[model samples]
Target: MNEQIVITFGNEKILTELKAAHPDRDLMMYQALSQPGEFMLLDHSGKDSVFKAPVFYDILSHSGEDKWDGFISFSTLDLNFDQQKVFDARINKLRTNGLPDGMHSIYSLNYHKDISQRIILGTWDDYADFELWKNSSDEFIPKEYRDSPNFYSHEAYYTPAKTKKTQ
Candidate 1:
């Protein structure tokens, strides 16, 4: 079944206000680990979801645990059909064999309004754990795959939103 996930970027104030306004909605917020003042709001409600900001995506599929703590990783990639096949295989292998330690959940989502692109979301135990997998992931992709002009990938890491108690 097709689901929808909204992505919004801003400071914590926006997220806090939105949460306060919609107390019952299941929303997950985060702050970019490397970028200050950058926050992300994730709304999984398939119905009348509210995203005040301009970023949102229609999720083709979502898997893994809904709980995310420690750190969150978001990545986007654009590839052609052949590249997608290989990409799918590699991702499937990882899922089938089990994700590496310290990685809690992994989600493969289609880019908003574009099936040719993909968005990967992962929850990690810490920055170190994410770095480890990222370094090794280069070896998993075929060398020829990198030569394709259609390949484009960008990944960012974020820490979960800090509550008033933690702040």
Candidate 2:
């Protein structure tokens, strides 16, 4: 069976809170490699839990086609309009242009069971590739729309945290 996972992003205090609140849950935590106090926590068997913190947390599903790890990029986008077309176009471009150098795979996911909310999870060997991809901008979505109030994005990057739970 596939693992049902939920990912959470927050600071040290929130991480501690999560651990304390869900001690029995199988979790893997990642710390931001360059940014202190930032972390990403994954609950591998988290289908039943509802984490209601101000910090970001969402159910994650993947295509199950690629192996992903090392540097990670998690971007959450809140779109005012349906984004299926935009997402499809971006994936097609990646297939045509090939992934950025040192980047392994990228997955687009639905956020918190909301269709209008989307997440982009990217795995890379270096952070530069992520920066490049983010700055490259999507041609399918016009700059004005992306910059307007209709679109909002929050992103963070991390590496595996040194912890027994993660191991």
Which is the leading candidate under lDDT?
1
List runs of model 1 lying over 4 Å from the truth: 60-63, 139-143, 146-150, 164-167
The sequence of per-residue lDDT tens digits that candidate 1 reaches over residues 98-148 is 777788877777866787778877778888997888777763445565676
Measured with C-alpha atoms, the lDDT of residue 100 in candidate 2 is 68
The runs of at least 3 residues in candidate 2 whose Cα sits more than 4 Å from the true structure, single-residue gaps closed, are 1-4, 9-27, 33-35, 44-68, 95-97, 137-142, 164-167
| Range of the 10 consecutive residues with the lowest summed lDDT in candidate 1 | 60-69
| Cα deviation of 130, candidate 2, in Å | 0.9
Report the CA-based lDDT of candidate 1 relative to the real structure: 0.73
The deviation in Å at residue 152 for candidate 2 is 1.1
lDDT of each: 0.73, 0.64
lDDT per residue for candidate 2 within 1-167, as digits (tens), equals 33344766776666766766777875557898668667777664636644654233353434333433477887767765546666656666775676766667666666555767677777787688677767785643457657787577778778777653321
> How close to the true structure is residue 22 of candidate 2, measured as C-alpha lDDT?
74
